[model samples]
Target: MSRVKTAGALNKYLHLPLVLTAVFILINAGVYLLNTRAGILVSGGLVIYIILILVIYGRQRENMLNDLVTFATQYGQVQRKLMMDLALPYAITDDRGKLLWFNDAFAELTGKDRKSFRKSIASIFNGMSPDKFPARDQEIEYETVYNRRDYRIQIKSVVLDDLIDNSQILERDDQEESSMLYAFLLFDETELNNYIQKYEDETMVCGMIYMDNYDEAMESVDEVRRSLLTALVDRKINKYFQDLDGIVKKFDKDKYLIAMRTRTLNELKGLRFNILDDVKTVNIGNDMAVTLSIGIGANNGSYNRNFECARMAIDLALGRGGDQVVLRDGDSITYFGGKSQAVEKSTRVKARVKAHALQEFIEASEKVVIMGHKMMDIDAFGSAIGIYRASRTLNKRAYIVVDSPTITTKPFIDEFENNPDYDSKMLLDVHEAKEMVDDKTLLVVVDTNKPDYTECEELLHRTGTIVVLDHHRQGNNYIRNAVLSYIEPYASSACEMVAEILQYFAEGVKLKSIEADALYAGIMIDTDNFMSKTGVRTFEACAYLRRGGADVTRVRKMFRENVDDYRAKGETLSNAEMYRDHFIISVCPSGNLESPTIVGSQAANQLLNIKGVKASFVLTEYKNVIYISARAIDEVNVQIIMERMGGGGHLNMAGAQLPKVSVEEAVRRLKRVLDATIEGGDLE
Candidate 1:
């Protein structure tokens, strides 16, 4: 087929030259046939014509060759463009891995133009070597950056063996090949990976809700009553979620699953779920209240992980005795509710065990230094003093660290200051406290176990020998390095723990009247004069204090506030607002005269006075910090709510500090978390 085409092309060329020659010959013959003079002129004209024909034939051949070159150039350009349009970065390289050709897409993907690309592929790719690349039909995936854009690139190499073989077909077997060629295809996956990462992040927040006491709520009810209850729950839920965008589905008769976008989560954070107090008031035939337990998972990096976290939070709420809201974010867990009643627990064994452990810890240290939470109250002061007395009995040098100016209990501070035996030199500031702390120094943390709330966080960290005694519910931040930990949430106050430990050490030895009074004052302050949250152990501890010469009248006098302070407390209580059936919220801006502790407690107590109120919370400003106090009347769990704000206490009472946040901002954040708890949403 090739030979036939070549012959035809050659024949066409020969025909053109032959026609020119024939025309010239014919002109010369005509000139000879004419007269002599005319013949000579005609001959010269024929010769000129021959020269013209030859020149034209040569020009035609040159044009054909130019056209062929032009066609080849256009064809190569079209092939390069076609490869680029295929969505892959394409490049041509010689056997030595040197780039010989590349299209616009290749340059764009590599952030290098054709000139730079030809110089060296490794110039753009750091640490890349030609020898490391795989052969034809094999591909490798690697990460690279181009023009500040991160990408996962796929590199492939191909050998032009067929082209090379054809070119060298006539060459000797021993002849060395001059060059080899390879084609590379690079695909950008940066945007795709980013999209996948976004999806993973969104999926991780999960929400869960469980119906507390479902069986109890349904007991004694017929099928018709059960259906009515279910319908009512569904209607309330649908209505509550009308404004929020999320998928709400009934997982079971007593469970629900909800999926929401992150934007929806942020929006839901503002709705105080405490407003759903009416949900617990669902009236059936027996007038029984039905409450829901909600768990929200936050901090999961993926949707499935968040879902699992939400499930775990719900389980924790149920395990701790339901009818509450549980939120777990990372390592921290917060709870709300459990105020209606506390599950009865016996702590006799725990107390005895803790007592033995405390003795062992005391024996191990060179000396014991007792401290309390910042802004020391009577409970903190009493607890520290009790621990100091215990250390004295052991013949160990002891110190009670206190910042008196920051003390909330002015009378208690003054009384300690006036004591003849009190050593002023031993009282250390945070920096001096660090110098005093050592491996041999037994640092006993009283009243609170939270590091941020401690009077001396540096002392806690510096001392290897440590002990913690508190009455607050266990939180994630509870001291972990304590040689001994005696935490009893059921106890009324830290003073109770100190008194109990002192009894174990003294064995009926009488406490001084002042010491006894200070201890009694702590119990009274925490228990609201034994009107709320007084358990059997609390009263027993109080009775012991009374026997030890605690003057009831004197203790009452210590609690008496100045007329201005009293008026401030009364004003704060007057601002309380009742929301839902169970909760009351009040904002108390007590100015400079009122301590946050005083204002928060005053508002909490006043909220309890309202008819049908089960729980009360107060937001108060003191200095630059916003303080929060939560109180409940055996029907609400206030500790969990306070814990969410980085505070922990008993089921009935808890307090927290919000640094650098305005009282209004703290209240707004608190309401959002409360709303999610009351309602149901993803926790993680």
Candidate 2:
């Protein structure tokens, strides 16, 4: 095999030499065939042929050398262009790891001159050795500082081939020759790192404490004591924020704004932000405990929105009688720490002042008209009669708006029918009331404040001047057009309030026996024979009625029901079901001589017979309207439960009017409210 290969190589080289010799012989032989002149020409031609051959060989060698140089230059230019166009820093190194070449971007990234960069890439990389770097085609990212600025750098290496013919030229083979080790590329992501840091810092959240009863606390304190207490509060607030890198700005005398980065919201779970327990110990005077209400707004979208929510929650906490914390998140509200009872306020001065104001309003109007709830009860009729007498003092035309068929006051109905002066037109319907109503007409609503419950809702709308006298607790649905609203929830009945108002205007007035009897009956029925729900004002109003010739025996007779009605009440109580800790519910079938309200109340009273029962509710159907009557024993808030069904009253006694719903459906809704209350969920 070696011999055959050697012969083939010799033949290929010998052919080139033989072809050159043949071309030289042909040129000399052609010159010899010419004459002496031809022989001289032939000799010159022979010399020229030899010279041309030498010139051709020299030109071929020069062209080969030029081509090699051109190829080397083009290769170098292509490599340089590739490095410049790349987005990352790159470098080329020899077998010994000495930097041979690097891009301009690399010099900028490392903050070093090209000469120093060639000596050491490790100086800019915090002394990281390339020799210690792992095998080629691998990449790593790390953080380092260049020119005192933080940076993130990525380094990569790849193997390059260095060969002459078929043999590798390593530095060990020839001291001056070295093999190419690797080509490295780097990426600078410092701007990306800065963006991530900014995002993390911005995501950190911040949260407030307000003094709710500031005015009530400082009302009786001396100036020196007040100043000291204020300073103490400020110091405590500052101390709480000191370790958190926060600030407490005093925006008002009673309010302070706290600002803190809430990178630790999870750690604050169940921790009291208001700190009212500590503040309450700081006494002002008169044994008045210093109380405060706090508002916390969390997970709010913006700083302005959070501040507004906190402010609103604080106001609600204060309005609900202080000593509480209210939390508001968007539309949701939560409460904590309002276990204390509201302080009883003195209303005698307010009542007296309101009496004078009402007198002026009554005197200025063209006429005085009184009305009450659609189904007029004893309280409603009695309060209207009491207002009628007050109108006589101003010599104004007095009218009572009512539906005669719906009147629950049987005796009063009989009395009006028997009287010669009593006219049927005097008991005006809502339409008739509207015709007589005007801006000058004064409307006095009694027994109830809710507009939908009023007998003459349109009369209120027709007349600009209005007044409301009610004993029930205030609800969201109230008579907004009224000029005078004498709503005293503490008062036993509306009759009591009207009776007191009548006395204020009763200096030189003549007493009417029928009107006096009506008012006395109203006070009796609401107070349950002066045994329950009676206050100091209740008996005082009853005493005024006795002075006006109101007979107690006749008042009792007005409440008399037939034997069958009494039996129905007993039947309702027999079917009651007790649930949860305090609630007792019962359903009574529709047919009965007694009204649903009376049956429901009797059923509620019977459920109270249970040992642990705190509240009782009776749901019964009558004339397509589901009547829900609720009663409680001080501890249970029945009004809140009833309000969820779109009705409201006092804390212990309440009723709701549901439209055309069945007893089963109503009971299901009632159970839902009870479950939510038991589970400590929001009422609405």
Candidate 3:
């Protein structure tokens, strides 16, 4: 290649010298051919002209060569000086990832002296070398060895044939082959990141603090000490925010608004917002403890936006039973502490008020349609029946929407179906109900507030006037357009809430024997036969039902398990295994069982009897959908665990459904979720 390139250069510049030589030869030959004095004289003059032309051309060529040499020398010196004096950390690497050369800044940044720089770039830079460059330039953040500071790195490709080290590579090669090289330039970004972190630390975060059960707490104290108790609560709250440099103001009787810096807020988060525990320790002579519901909003667009988020968060915290901290960053929410059970309200004034409003709505509607969640359990069905009775009490036509009932609810439904006084047309299937619904019909949703979980979501959409009555905590997807919503997370069950509402009905309006028994059964099943979540109002509602002639014996017989279901439960318990030290997990074997979910719940309850177990989970697959029943005994919040898997229930007992997964896969996913909850400090 070098010889061919030399011949081409000679051919390009040979024209000037060859033309001069040819002209001289032609003049000499013409003079000799003339053979005369005149021709000889002319030839002599041409010789001088040729000599002058040759000398001028030679001098011009020499000067051009000298100028080229000078420019090359100067360019080489300037390039060398730039490499040595450049402020940015710079380095060059060959195709093999070996470091060919580096500037002083790079050596200093990497904490390597010239003597110690004889290593590969990857080895020196902690293995960040790129084998090939991307088509476009890329900027990356790198950490240096000097002080572990961050650097913004830029790399560009430098072909060997065009690089300053081309001669060195060519000299070392026997069969010359051009290779690829890279030029790296790095700028320190440590200070920039520090500035960003400082801004984050100083950012303002908004929050709201609610004194849950404030009126009840104050009422429990002596009349003379009530002011003192309020002062004490204020002192605790003020002192809590004193060190945080936060501004706190009491906006209402039970609510306080606060503004705090994100640095202190993060510290509070790390400590799990111990204010909830701290306030509980304050003693004002009240038998019941006072708790707090704190909601924080961070990383939002504006202060007002964050404040709005905080307000929504506090509502959610209180709806989920209070004694918790909820942090809302835009659409995502993270919960901190919610260990205490909800305190049942001391008065039913709200229930009475809501009942009156519902009566007014029902009085104006043409007809009423009541519905519950799918797989209607006793609490769901009983709540539906209670609402239906309430509509009848108002002297309006009503219907109960029922679909494929589960085994647990089949007997209770059968009693109603067999009753003579009950209207056979009152029970409507989802399809018929959808057809019957109109703009004037009142849709009262019971047991569950989520539209997705309703028996007839299509009918729900068609109905104009709707009322929501539920005991579960308000979730993200609640029915938003209800004219009236009565959701009390503190209630024992939906039936218990509806039963309370039934008491406030007009005079001479009453519950039938079967309706009373069904409502009582709903209360019993949800409270685990009054063994869990039963409050004062729970028993009061049951007493009212008994007064209405609710036969306990009949309700008990309705809950009796058939032989096949009993066998399924026993088989499920046989496969129980302990996990996470003390929690039991059992996957029910696939079979044509009548009620797999009932068996799963029964099996979960029985697993709690094991000596050291604190929680139990039963997995059962029916028609390719894996159903899980999670139960805990004062040691875990299985509700949150199930909520993470798209299900929700009470704190100690919850269930989840996993679609299109086998029993083994469901168990594996359950374990992984348990692991994450435990690792994330939400569970023990």
Candidate 4:
């Protein structure tokens, strides 16, 4: 193909001029017709002129072509010499990344001689893989550290046929057909990366620090030492930030603004924000230790946006209960120092404020749809009832959304089924709720804040206004767009939080005996009959329910288990295995029980009473999902362990659901998580 193309090019450039000259002789015949003597003289002169010109031109053309070939040869030699000893690091590899050839620069840098050069790029470059290479039309670049210098390698894929037509060095010997080859050119980017790293280290990280229990800690100490306690805390915080090359500005008595370089933030992260514990231990004869919540925002592209993210992160840390560090980097959020339980708020002023906000939302809305988590438990049902009661009080149409009510919630659901006082449309299914929602409707989510966990997640997007009321620790999968979000991890139950909100919903908010009973049942069930997580506010909510004609005896009788449930709980307990002499694990039998997951939770709670058990986990298979109920005392933090499996709750009580896995696989995963937790020293 090359020879044909070369011959055609020569014909166009060297033969066409001779053919034109012959056509000129035929035109001279017309001159001969006019004057024979003159035409003969002209023709003779023209023939002589053409002969001399062709002889001279032909000789020069030969010399010109030879000189051109000679120049091309030297040009090719110079190019070959330049590529062989080029200063830039360059190498050739086959499509599978096996080294074919390399320049002196690349050979010297890689210390690869011809004898030992038959290796893949992966062996030469620390992390290169064959699959990481680009295709024939595409180019790829990657960074690696060679020796002590950072190198940027740019790989260009070439078809062998494209190069062989142009250069002898690229000719193939072994391969019968054209194939792809990669040419690698490496640049020393050590100095550039050093500058980039310096800039990154200098990048500002904006954050906010808030004293989680300023008033409570102060009140716990003597009045005279309160000033000293305040001074000590301030000094501790200032010194801590200063040591990290940070600046702290006191915005309020309990709040501070902090600015630090990214390097400082990294140092703090490596320390796991130890200042959280250090600040708590700074007790100047105070009965209650003070805790701190830190929120940091980095890599948000601007200082103001970072500060805004910091504010949002701080709010999240507080919402999940304080005494933690939340790092917000754009859309990603991370938590550390959440080992301690959230401190319960002593003041009801915030509840009153939220209640007032709820009143405004309800009054402005045309209707309200109350929803709860799937497999609705007593706490979920009671919180829905509480919101339903509040909505009805404001003369707005209200409906409770329930999907496939579970056994634990059936009895309470039955209490409202035949009641003539309640409207027939008060209880709505998921499909009905989706149809009922509109721009004028208010969506109130109770017990669970995650949209997926809700009975009708579609309703959240359907309604313009959403109100989230939850007592569990806010997971990463939370309702981000809500008009009012009140997540109190410290509260015993969603019912307790709603009870407080109801107190301030109106001046004279009256609760029906059934409504009071439902609310009472939620708190009772969540707190395990007021034995776990019962703070002053928990009891206060229960007392208010009592005032509203909630009978403790009636609530217990309503939730009492049947014979099968009791037997299942006993079996779970008897089958429990002690892990590491502290943790207990067991499986609960469904045994025709409608709510086997709840039975697992009860079994987990029962396991904590064992002599050396610090935490308990009970697994139950129901509806193709393996539900794990986790319980722990102050000795261990179970929430973090459960979060690994995509669940979250309070420090003592948490649960997770593993879908599309066998019971044996779920148990193996649980054991792995437990082992990882133990190795990580989280339980300590």
Predicted candidate 2 versus true structure: per-residue lDDT over 120-232, tens digit per residue = 55654665576655465576666766665565655555534334434555334455433336555665556777787665444433335666546555655776688877777
Summarize candidate 4's per-residue lDDT along 565-636 as a digit string, tens digits.
999999999999887778899999986988999899999998988998889999999989999999988888
Q: Model 3: per-residue lDDT, tens digit, 1-684?
A: 112222367557745666866787787777777777867787777778778877886577656656666887999999988987899988887666677788888887777774556677777666665644433333334455436777766776665455535565444353666556767788888889889999998989999999988888988888898888878888899888977788899988778999999898888888889889888888868877789999889888888899889988898888788988989977778877776777899799988998888889999999999999987888989988988998898888999889867888889888888888888889889888988899999999999878988998887779779999998876667788899988888898998998888888664349898899889989998887887788899999999999988999998988898888888788888878889788899977657677778778878888888889988999888877888899887888888888888887767878888899877788888999999988887764
Task: Give the lDDT of residue 314 in candidate 2.
Answer: 69
lDDT for every model?
0.71, 0.70, 0.83, 0.89
lDDT of 1 at 355: 64
lDDT of 1 by residue, 1-684 (tens): 112222367667657767867876776777778777887887787778778777886677666656766887999999867976766677777666678878777776666767754665677666556776666657776687767666565666664555556784644344664334556666667788788767654553567877765665676467678889877876676556555766677879988887766655556655645524557656667345677777778776666777888987875565444566677766767555555543223345556567667777776788878888887888888877777767776767788777643324777777767788676654566666777778888899998877777897888778778888887656556677777767655577889877777777735335778888888888888878788667777777888888988999988877776766677677777877767556788887666564656756766876787888877888878778888888877666666667666776766777788889987798788887677656743221
**Ranked candidates (TM-score, high to low):** 4, 3, 1, 2
lDDT of 4 at 547: 97
RMSD after CA superposition, every candidate: 18.3, 19.1, 6.5, 3.2
TM-score of 2: 0.56
Error of 3 at 464 (Å): 6.4
Query: Quick one: best TM-score, which candidate?
Result: 4
| Regions of candidate 4 where Cα sits further than 4 Å from its true position | 1-5, 8-10, 26-35, 49-72, 114-116, 161-178, 574-581, 589-591, 675-684
